[model samples]
Target: MKAVALYGTIGSLVLTALAAVPAGGLTRPDTAGAGTPAPAPPRIAFGRCAPVERLPSSVECGRLTVPLDYAHPRDRQITLTVSRARATGGPKVRQGALVFNPGGPGASSMHFPMYGKTERWRKTARAYDFVGYAPRGVGRSAPLSCQDPAAYAKIPSASPREPSAAFKRQKYAEAKAYAEGCARKAGPALRHFTSANNARDLDMLRAALGEKKLTYMGASYGTYFGAVYATLFPGHVRRMVFDSVVNPDPRQIWYRNNLDQNVAFERRWRDWARWVAKHHKVYRLGTTPQQVLRAYDTVRARLGHRPLAGKVGSAQLQAAFLKTGYNDAYWPVRAAALSAYVKGNPKPLLRQTLPQPGGEAADENSNAVYTAVECNDGPWPRDLRVWDRDNTRVARVAPFETWDNAWLNLPCAFWPRHAPRGASQDPARFATDVTDAALPQAGAAHRPVDVRTAPGALPPVLLLAAERDGATPYPGAVELRRRLAGSSLVTERGAGTHGVSFGTNTCANQYVERYLLTGRTPARDAYCAARAEPKPVLPAK
Candidate 1:
């Protein structure tokens, strides 16, 4: 769930007209000795139906049948759930479809069509059908579920530090057992849950919808889904807006990303501690930021020795801390809870949500899919020594969240299936071929494409980054923009949350709305300044 953050100082904003390059220039020639080029995708058929079980009259639902594997179309088929909000305006000026994806490699998009009803979205909905699809292994589609909900309850919230050697042994044993349980229960579909497969499925949806191209807005983990789809079916994409981009480096994997996330969160926590220091009366830890930090560490260390109230152990505390780092909105709530817990009044902090037991089935499903896609797309360090060294270094610098992240993904060490081989990374094939003069010339130098996979042609994409995001640091977003050619990045300078859409900032909402409504892609990279005050007002009264 880690994502690229959108932050830092205001960079120069310039607009320019980008000339569309020839299709051949954007795509790599198929070098494989091919008998003949594959034919274009078939035209799709559509039909209307009554509203889905619980949706409003305005929302319509249908099912699309897609091949289980594009490579073997006749082999098997799977069902995909699709929802739509029809255009509301009188006469359509442009006919198109706008697809939506919410993060949660596991979250459902069943109700996403209703998002089109928001005031900002109303303008775009006039000429387009706002579409939402629940991908395979998720809601409405054939879902992957655990047989026992109670089993999830027993898994225990992440407790990275076992009090005794016996406890450590038990934790590792339990993690391994859970992994085996998934292997036994998840069936063959588990191996097919990689993101590349998901991307293929998305293309099928596009073909099924009878649309010549795909227009999409994806958030959080959704951004990666969009990126993968764009990479695989570039010609099929009309416009794409990837908010809170995920790092595409497959080597880092989930575990390494989480380790980086821990460090980022700790830095943000210190910033919050400083804010708490200023308002000492509301929730006083200490008068200075340093004192607040020391106080917090003392409380964490104490919990390490003995579980708070004989229940909230050091591990649970760490998990809670990581969740708190997601949004600035939760900082005060977490601060108050931490202050009370440190004072021996742990009831307030006890409100934290614990990962359910046996719930590892769902968690594993999501985690497995996350890892499978990443691992399949590229290789990872097969060496345990490398992980040990990295974990040790991460633990020293960012102790609070590191170990918990390690344990959350420790199962990857013994993943049952071999990592999938991917095409070599060819930056030119996948990204735009714009020269330096076309790009913004400030900030960190963009990271070279690291994955050694065959690059596919990708369409022009709109990337969104939030300034204060703790998980995916802002630098990651800037780096992603640099690597992705022809992609325009819109920075939400002050938005503190990870995902940019769904009521974050008007600037973000307006920019996205304009693009989706009129195909008015920003002339160049732009920035959406963080909202200075609540309830942004329209231009003038």
Candidate 2:
């Protein structure tokens, strides 16, 4: 879940545009991935959240104080904002807390506990107190900020076409500047803003919540967070559901993962293009995928010449179109917008791409924390030449997002967390065989949080994945299934959406709900055919 609005590589685009852990083997430090368990904290004094939170009246919120760096639990502390909606059913039906995290290493999920209010989730709501939290370095939890909103907004967008030497230099300069800004603002604290630490914090939260075993649901990058938690506390996990899973291959952790996303996004783009083409009678964009693509290219190129109403330019065009890859729900509106633009009305496209007023701070904070988590998670290439070469190559085949994603992650090259000594930093090795069962592992310091569990060490994990998922590709679910013993995958075939279970797809949702409600899973892997694509939004003319 690393393709969000504005900034490309952070997480879910739709949520940005619009808008855990384990049971305690308490009183002890984790053997592998966490720090010493903190002392018992006070019960979360639930109260009304701010109006800005948009949480339901039943959803009460509170805060827990936790160690900023788990290694020294006695040192600097930070506040973790927590929210809860208690189980509606009687004691016989209660199953403790069921936590939710909706991707973005930076996405604030203090509002997520309210998701149970929806009809699709009401059954699970009756059985468990839906819990949500803002992880360390996110909203209301010692929020992180790297750049000035004004400065960040002014930062130039990556070129849509093949980059020239001058443009590449500009991008590197921007990346270095962005990196330096983070170092200047957040300083050494940025190192602790990591997935490993996030997992550690979740364990602390679990202990505080008094849960002996953790039951959780995560989407996109949240799956990675869950995987890390399971790796660290396998015995504490009661049940889990990962929707749109992140690939857990040590070799693909941070760098190679983005490269893989480029190819996947291109495929999803084609899927959207084909959908648009089939509706040519209404959209008039094209009658074939290639022609639809040409229409997109034409609009992008024309935007470079003249931004719509002086707001949406080529880069904005790309960002708007990028959401199409994330979910087909955006397809009709997007197709209509593009069609409108081609027909000489830029207002629809303008409405789609313009930034919301006063939302700049949230955007800046999201990008800052995203870079901090990714850069600190593992080693990235230290050299720009390496990035230039790899992104350039990927751009040839997956041009839609390759360079754009490259620019989003460029800051990693200059991040304060340097590659570990003696760790494998070869991006190429992982590129060729990312899904190989027997992958050459990186050093302990550089590898992804070791997620492999001893047989039966963990509970049955249910994976919900869309076949053509763009943000967190489908293969990630497959790899995660292999790593987590007894895990079952319910794949939504031919679907390109990022998150699956919450959508209209009853097939995938059945597996998720059943597993959450009864702790049951398919005997083996299962499949769910995706529903038909959205019909054209514009009326036939």
Candidate 3:
């Protein structure tokens, strides 16, 4: 699952109030020629939702059975769990459901509707029923899982470090074994756990929700999901707000994206390091970015031989610091942990990261789903030599996360290529016609998405990007906005956070409120300054 979060800075829309469209209507032209939707599926059979700890008591949950393969509607079925919070109707008729996805490709979003309960969503919650659902093979939706939750811990993550032939063999073997484990343990879902499949399932969900057009807010990887859905079912999308946009470059998919991630994370780390160095007197870790990174690197080196709490290894230590890459909020906390560990007390970093023994390890199912989607979404270079060369090259410059994220997705190289019926869909080639008899062939490598068939005119789509987001960087929004006509690009000028919308920046959230509730996007592409930097955190007592 991709790491995600809130808040970033810079985008200005003329708040010179244009007459807000009737809350129910959008100014976008009709989608008449786009295509027609299938008849509404049997109204979702709503059942009593057992209360969950965080969800509102009145939020209802239901399950919808969708074909595992849209190619064969009668084939095996999988169910997705959906949750909803009914809008508090005001003077106007409700504007249908506002679907949400918190991203991950693995994060359970059953509680997404809870955003409506928070003040962030206060201005617009009543305009639409907020709906959230666990996408296929994710939390509570016939989850995809592996046999070993500790799989990642057993092997060292791919290293940006130059590896010997022996290390290469070990990585290859581990990656192969990990992929096989998913096939054996995750069962039959691997073949179908793809964005294309999920996009189809979402259409079915849209049908079940009784909506001819869909309104959605998808973050991080969820934005990719919505993109796939829009590409697959363009006519059905009414309004979409994509936040912390995932790179939709058909050429990058998972591999090159991770390469970009290496560059981004190291850049973000430097940002944190500089910030730490700025507050050098208070934390006393270092007085320059180089010095702070050296101190941090020293701690990681020590963890390489001795894992903290026997669970937080060098890789785990780096993972713990990733929050700082997402936003500055965790700077003090991670800085404190880093400061404490370097000063002979390792407990704070341990408590902050691996709270319990083995807690830092990824959950079995989560890792499994992360693998399922990334691997299945597109083809990976299967040649170990290719991987070695590319990774060795990336290490020379963008070294920090190059190998770690590489091995994170390496399982795909060895994933079972032969499906029970045939090959899986060719993500590059749009599934204009899916068929059980002749599903797209997934060769060892595939081509980039054909832009000739890219998504077309529709509603004015909105995209949110931060100036320096590590996970889903800003360039992605540029590429996507070009492809999605009438889409407006909004930048948080200095916001470093990944998931920027509906969070800390009043300006960004205000834009979201305007678009989602008033059907008014920024008058033009806009930029908002990031909120003032958060003050340093006081170390825990």
Ranking by lDDT: 2, 3, 1
Writing each residue's lDDT as its tens digit, candidate 1 over 1-541 gives 3342222100000012212213322211122232222223444333453444367877877887765544345556677778787777756464677777776565556676776677756777777887877777765466554234355434224354323456545655555555455456655555455555566666666666777678887776666666656554556678888777666553343444566676876676666777677767666688998888778777777766776556666666766666546666556667778777766677777666344444455554444444434333333333344445666677677665666665555444444442232222221222322121231111111111231112345555678877766767666576656655667778888555666654658888877777666666675578887754222111110
- Ten contiguous residues with the weakest lDDT in model 3: 8-17
Q: Rate the local accuracy (lDDT) of all candidates.
A: 0.57, 0.76, 0.69
Query: Model 3 — TM-score against the truth?
Result: 0.85
Q: Write the per-residue lDDT of candidate 3 for residues 15-122, one digit (tens) a residue.
A: 122121122222211122232232234678765675642466778888888776543456577788998888877658588989887777676677777777788886
Candidate 2 structure, TM-score to reference: 0.90
Q: Estimate each model's TM-score.
A: 0.76, 0.90, 0.85
Q: Please rank every candidate by TM-score, starting with the best.
A: 2, 3, 1
For candidate 2, write residues 212-263 as lDDT tens digits: 7788887788888789888777878889888888898766778888999999
Please list the residue runs of candidate 2 whose C-alpha ends up more than 4 Å from where it truly belongs after superposition: 1-23, 26-37, 155-158, 418-447, 539-541
> Could you tell which candidate, 1 or 2, scores higher by lDDT?
2
Model 1 TM-score is 0.76
